[model samples]
Structure formats: structure tokens, C-alpha cells
Target chain A: MDLDMVKYLAELGKLEFSDEELVKTANEMTDIIDLMDTVKEIDITYDALKDNHNAYLNDLREDVPAPSMETAKVLQNAVNTNNCFVVPKVVEQSLSKGVVIKWTYLQ
Target chain B: MDVSSMTIRDMRTALDERKISATELEGEYIANIKKYDDKLQSYITVTEELAMKQAEQAQKLIDDGKAMPLTGIPMAIKDNICTEGVKTTCASKMLENFVPVYNATVMEKLESQNIIMLGKTSMDEFAMGGSTQTSAFAKTKNPYDLNCVPGGSSGGSAAAVAGGLAPAALGSDTGGSIRQPSAFCGVTGIKPTYSRVSRYGLVAFASSLDQIGPIAKNSYDCAMILNAICGYDPHDGTSAKVNVPDFTEKLGQSVKGVKIALPKEFFGEGIDSEIKSAVLKAADEYKAMGAEIIECEMPSLKYAVPAYYLLACAEAASNLSRYDGIKYGHRTANAGSYEELIIKSRSEGFGDEVKRRILLGNYALSSGYYDAYYRKALALRQLIREEYAAIFEKCDVILTPTTPTVAYTPEMTSDPVQMYQADICTVTVNIAGLPAVSTTCGYNANGMPIGMSVIGKKFDEATVLQVSDAFEQGFTPVMPKL
Candidate 1:
């Protein structure tokens, strides 16, 4: 991996790497990839795209919200309750399983 | 009895015998916190008033012969856990003032035991860094050597315990966060089975791998804290329903005939001589106790770091997307556009290391390269788990150094790879979701501590503690008196 590759990767990862960090990451990736390449020589048969060993892995379903989180309470945590996502909020968990438990146990 | 070094078992005896009051113990710790926390930077918030109130309540209960185990015993927690009404920053500017309205399940468990909470300690921002240097607040110094770092993101928890500021502390382990710092600080730390403790209240840092565990002066104390804090919480979907052992029950049991595997990879070249010797010395002691010792090897051990970074970063990116500065954390005022709002919020909220990880993780989990990096790492993770399961079948526990090296000075290794290498000895357990511990086994000539890791099968904390305690007796090397 070169500096350009590192910079591109950092960008994709959402990281803003410093100029110094760019060099360091490039060097490390170069070293690691070099070693991996050497190791792969014994096992490097380039399988075609879909025909590869892991191509048929299960595709998980997108999680759908089902009666979770109350709107009023959820919005309470929003800094701009007037915004699309803002509203009044309460601490989520009930005290039964929270800070009140000790006192409840004591009582 | 000095509560700082005393295990929970002994502390309980004193409490029950009426030789010590819970109030007195809480006072002692509060005083210690006041005296020692400045240079140490171990705590972000100290709940002295609340702690005292809890202590007083426990004293009343004890007078009424109704006090429970851990009642009024003060313990510090890593700041990532929500503490209802208390600021629960994950050591990030983004949740700096976010007072959680709810208590995390582990906190609830401790509260149910009437455990007095000392306060929340510092951590690597979002529990991202190994040295705690990435915290938005301040770096937590290694209690043993102020110039050096305590291994992190649980550095503050370890420092709190090692500095005698608190009898015990809590830390989270994603990839050796708890155990690594405990090793450097010469404190006993346990990263319990994944889901062994609930994650409901902990600010997420790689959800699948994150586990909340205890840090203390000894394994037995760790077990007691585990007994109090471990159990299923309905709030956490992943909480384990395993039977909670009366952990103290087996503290005195001999570990004779316990089969231990010394993985060849952990002890080979590239290991610091001091760390290697300390681990070997601990193994020798385990041998004297009639435990069976055998050599084991995981050829795929070298792949752990690559796999861990890819997986950890991928999850981190998704988990951190919630902190866009709009909901919680640091935010810039009057950004002209939403894009600017988000950019400014993130840049202002996260530290450099956190931003770097977010980027790395995002890339791995991104659309085009997911199959090449993230999926491969997961596949390799399964291979590693199978290797551990097979190794466990041959041995009762796996032994190795907790970290390849001791605590390094701040910025000792600016190269990320050098820092990542420190975790090589620790990450396989996280990938496998098995229980592991790092206990002070010996010390180097410089008096720096060396920790040897004891890994056990899934939910097999009992055996892990047994072997660690047995080994601890004969491998007794004290901390350099820092």
C-alpha cells in the first residue's frame, strides 16, 4: 500500500489522517500486505466472483422497527425538539432494574 | 483491615464482624480519591455525596441485620456506563454532559447489592484507544509509573485500583481493554464471557465484542464483584442466563490437576524477555500445585490483529454514527448547513484516534469492500474460535502473557502498528467470546509489573479464577512499590 492508498482508505473510513499518519499507515499496510502476500502464495487460486467459496453466504434481513421506542420520549433527547428528530426525553430504563433497585431491596 | 488491598471476601468478614462500618470504608475511599486523583486523572466524576448516602444506608441495614453482600462497598466504574442523572461520558466530548436518565444493567446489579459507587472513571474516548491517551479529558497515568501509560481504554479503572484510590473498579473489554491495563497497573482484571454482564447501559464500542468486567487486587475479589454484577438483565437481549456461582465458594479449592495449555505463539520470539519470564514463572508455580501443563499452538494467531482491527473498526463506524452532535456530545453553534453541522460536531467531539478508527471501521463495512475485509475477518474470527474450542478440549485453561510488553511512556510508539502489536496476545479471546484474565504474576527488574493471562472456556470463569489464584501464590512478585 502506498500513501495514495492510505489516504483513500482513511477517507473511506471517515478518518482525517494527519500528513505524518498517512506515511505511517502506508508503511504499516505495505509491511502487513507484503507478509500476507507471501503467505497467500501457497493458497492463492483466484476464484471467480460468484463462484468463490464465500459467495453464497446468507443475506441477513434489514431490521424493521417493530413497536420499539416511543416517539415522545425519543424526541425528548433531541437538542432541537422542533427539528424532525427532536422531542422531550426521559431516562429510558425504569428504576425497577436501575438505581432504585438497591433502595427497593433495602425497603 | 486496609480495605484497599483486602479482597471482597475479607472485607465482608470485617463488615459482618462489626469491626468495620460501611460508612467508614466509604469515607476512607473518598478521602483517598481526594488525595490521589489529581496526578492520576483516574476519575472524571466522583460521587462522594451519593456514595456517602449509600454508605449510611448500608450501615443502617447492617445494624438491622439486613445488609447484603457488596452493601456499602465502594467501587469505581469506567465512565462509559450510564448512571441515571450522572454524566456518563464515554470519555468523549460528544457525551460530555449527557446525563443518562437510566442506569446500565451492571450498574443496576451493583446497586441491587447496595454497592456504594465511588464514581465514574475516565476512559479512551468512546473506549477507542489502548493507552487512554485518546480520551477527550486527560490521559490517565499508569499508577506504577506516572510517566508511562496504563494500558487502556480502561486505564482509569486500573489506575484507580492500583493507586489504592478504590478497592475495585469496573472496565469494559472489547479487545483486552480491561485485562491489558490491569496487567500494566499490576491489578487483577477479568474480561468475563461475552453477555456475562449486560451491555444495555454501556456506551457501545464494537457491540458484539464489548463486555463489562471487574478490576481488583485479586481474582477472588473479582469473583465476588462478578457474583454481584453478573447475571441476566431483561434490558439486554444478549444477557446470558447462566447460573451465577457463589464465586467465593471455590476460592479456597485447590487447582490440582487443572489442565493448562501454554500456547506456543504467545511465548515465542518477539515477546519481551521480562514478560515471557513472568508467564513462565507463573506456569512453573501452577506445576508445583499439581496442575497439568502442556504446549499448544494456534498457527492463525498472527491473523488476530488484522481481523480484530477490521471487525472493531467496522462496528465502531456504525455505532458512532449516533453521535453526530445533534443528539448528544459536542456540537458547533450555528453551522450554516446540516453537512457542516455534522462535520463540525464530529471533528469537535471526537479525538484524533477515534476519528481514525471511525474512518477505518467505515471503510471495512462500506459497500464495495465489505466482502474483502469485514467478511473475511469474520470468517477468520470463526476459524480462531474453533481453534480455541479445540485447544480447550485438550486443556482446561490457556496461559499466555496479557500483553507482549509492559506500559510504555506516552507517545512511545507513534506508529499505530506498534501499538496494535501490543494487543496480539489478547484479542483472540475477544473473538472467541471466552473468559480471560490478566493477573500480576511477576515484576521486571525495573519493578514494572508483568501479567500472565489465564483464558478459560466460555462461561468457565470458575476455573480461570482457580488457576490464576493458585499460580498467584507461588509466582508472588510485588509491584515495584510505585
Candidate 2:
């Protein structure tokens, strides 16, 4: 469990933890990984994953456009919304050599 | 009968006879909450207005001779179940202000019966831990002993039922959340077979493993609530198409010739001696009732803990990825980029246990480790399920301790692995997608309740409840001194 691996995992999960917390997490995860090693001993193959033994088969319903919640109710919990949830600008204006590059192509 | 102490059966009868108005019962529960919740802290939000309105509607229904089984019976919903126009916080700051616009299928069914919801109860944040101490809002103490934790993540539901705050409650069990708390609180709870109840609006912790069930004063009350809630729904893809039986049909029936399997693995090392003895005593009681108790072996169960955690965390990571502060839930105040915003929101919003699971989930699904951890665990899960299927061929129900020990002090929160081990006796039922019930067997010397579980085959909840109800025959509920 490298410290850098923990950092990479946090980034992947869209989570952030302090260095001290990450150290603790790495230690704990190492122990869990060790515990999980026992699973490798079970002589099971990939074909077993397909046999889910559950009654919930792929009973696909008709592809019909159904009514959904009202837009007003959907936007009720938005932190920042005018007509939609506000997010940080995806493609920002990059400044290069005292000149701003307007990314018109992306827009 | 004490209004707060009455079960759903008792309340329904009383309401039918016009001995009590629905409003009065609601008031009684509210009064009980006011008196005892200061110590138990079972509720996160109390819906007084909604309860009153529902009670009024229920009274009118009763007056018109159209009362359903659960009409006017007050319930405390585990915070994970979505309630329309009510805060379904999952006991985490990430959804501290989150309110769903639609009701969970269970809640909608209960609403059709005019059941009154008292409030949302406390749980482990995102239903991740065994102790209620993981809740970001408040630590729900066991009603039996204020210092000890009520087993969770349905601790609040159990504590409220045991403490006489609400007659019954709905609790979700991913891995023993409902049963463990019921055992610790000296009450009765049932976790139906997966897909027996719809999971349409349950805030998903682990999609395949989670099932919503009832925690109540007695097995009969639990069955009554189950009758009201269980059914197939078009909205839930995994909802079963089988007919929901009247779960209370076999109550008080003789257990003659019923063969119960006592898995040797559950009583092995690491189980508390007292819990082991109590479960054995319960087995003897069953024998006295003419039920056969056979010793069985489930070698694959040894891998249950790791397998459950791996699958649950993997599904949790994927199921919870939707909460990136875009549409609902807590969002960060400011950010210069979408990635930074998601990072900051998750960092600030989720509690420590949630972050740990997410990180571990990512690690399990990471490129190099996926084959070693996630895939193997999945295969192992099937093996565990197959082992149970084989055992059920010989036994009608499998008997075990609901938890390895009774309620412990909240100090167990310090060690995550130790906390996870608390679920060892119970998680296999979830893995097998079997119906199991945890009911009071006896009490530990410290006065904390000990529970024993009856696990039945898939969609065989009737047998599970019958066994539990018969086993609970002479055992009276132990009320907290609060």
C-alpha cells in the first residue's frame, strides 16, 4: 500500500482526505487486502458470475417514454440553479503569453 | 395497554374498537419521544404535522369502516428509505438537506394503508457500519443501557421501538442492519428475501444486498407490517413476481417436525460464550417443541466477511457515485473546476467511514487489483450462496445468533475491522438472499438483549417468521429502564 496509491484512489473516487487520514486509510486497506487474499483460494471460474440464481432476469419493459417528476421538483435540491444545476466552466479561457485564447471551437 | 408500548396488532384492534383515536395515539408517541429521546436520540427528524394529518385521515378511514392492518400505526423509518417531502438524510451530511420527491415503494404501500411515520431514525452514515456511532448527526444509544450502542445501522429504529417511542419501524438491512439492532434492542425484526420487497427509492448502499423490513415489538407486529409493505413493483427492476403471502398466517402454529440447521461455523471461535449458550438454549427450546435440530457445516461461510465487504463496497462505490454535488445533496460552495468541486463536495460532505469505503471500493476496482479482489469476491459470493442452497435442501431453517455478542460500548467504533466482524453471524443470509428474522432469545448479564436468528430459504419468509414467532413464545420484551 503505497501512500501515492492511496492518493490516486482518493482522486479516482472524487474524494479528498488529509495526509494523516490517507496514511491511516492505506494501512487499513492493506489489512483488508490481506484478508481478501483468502478469496483467491476458492476454485471458482468466470462462468459462475453469469449464473446469478436470482429471479430478477432481464425482463425488459416496453421502451415507452414515461412521465417523470416535474422540472420544478427536480431542481428543488440544487445548490446553484437558474434553469439547470450550475457547474464550474468545463473549458476555461487559457491565458498564454499576455493573450487570452478564446476556445471558440470547443464552444 | 400503554399507547407507546402497544404493537401494531394491539393498536389496530384498539383503533377498530374505537378505544383510542388515531390522534391520541400519535400524541402519545410524540410525548414518549419528548420524554425519552433526550437520552436515546433515536430520531433525526420528527414529522408532527405530517403524523397528525395522517392520523386524521386514518381516523376518517376507520370511521368509514375501511381501516387497513397498519392504519394509524406509528412507525419510525430508517433514514435510508426515501420519503416524499421528508428528509431522507441517510444520517450523513452529504444528504443532510436531501429530500426525495418520490416515496420508496414500501413507504408508498404503507401510506396507502394510512400508517403514520413518526420520523426518520438514526443509522450508520450510508448504512456502512455496525454501530450507530458512525452517524454524523447523533449517536443513538441503546435504550437498555445508555452507555452501550444499539446495534446498527438501524439503531434508531430498534431503540425507538424498545424505548417505546414508536410502536414499530421500517429498517433497511444490507448486512444485518435490521436484525442486529433488533437483537440488541430486545425486539423483533425480519429481513425478507432479496427482491421480496421493492427497492425502488431506497438510498442504495449496496444494491443487490439491501432489503427494507420491519422492526417491531413482537414477531406478529413485524409480520403485520410486512404484509402491508411486501409486493412486486414495476418501478423496481429486482422486485419479485411471486405472490406475497400473509406472513402472520402461521403464528402460534406448532413447530412439530421442523428441521433447523445449526451451522457449526457461526458458533466457532470469536463468538461470545454467553451468546453461544443462549442460541443453544433457543435450540433446545425448539427441540422441546418437537423441532429437529441438526448440526450442519458451511465451510464456504468462512469467507463471508471479506466477500460481503468486497461486494458491498464495490457496489457502494458505484451506487454512491451519483452524489457528486451536481443535481441534489450537499454541494461545495465554490470551485474553479468541476473535478475540484466534486472533490471538495465529497470531502466536506461525507463522513469518515463513507470516505474509507469509497477509497477501498476504488482500490478493489483499481486496474491491478480488480481481478485479485472484486472478481474473486464475486465468485466466492456465488459459492456461499450455493452452499446455503445445498444446506436448505436438508433443513427448513438455519438457526444462529443474530450477533456474536450483545450490544457493546460505543468504543468499538475505533476499529473498523472489529466492527465489521460483528456482522459475521448474519451476512451469509444476505449473501444467499434468504429471509431471516432476529427475535429476542434472552438477555446478557448486563441486561442487554441477546438475539437468535431463523434463516429460511428464498421467498420463504413465512417459515422464518413462524419459527421466530414460535421461538419467541414465552420470551417477553425487556423494556429499557429509561
**Scoring model 2 with DockQ, what do you get?**
0.60
Q: RMSDs, each prediction? A: 8.1, 2.8
Model 1 regions more than 4 Å off? A1-78, A82-107, B475-482
What is the model-wide C-alpha lDDT for candidate 2? 0.88
Q: Which stretches of candidate 2 lie above 4 Å from their native place?
A: A49-52, A94-107
Predicted structure 2, TM vs. truth? 0.96
lDDT, candidate 1, residue B59? Answer: 85
Root mean square deviation (Cα) for candidate 1: 8.1
Number of clashing pairs per prediction, in order = 12, 0
Q: For each candidate in the order shown, give its overall lDDT on alpha carbons.
A: 0.80, 0.88
- Please state what fraction of the native interface contacts candidate 2 reproduces: 0.68
Q: Given the true complex, what DockQ would model 1 score?
A: 0.12
Model 2 residue pairs with clashes: none
- The TM-scores, one per candidate, come to 0.87, 0.96
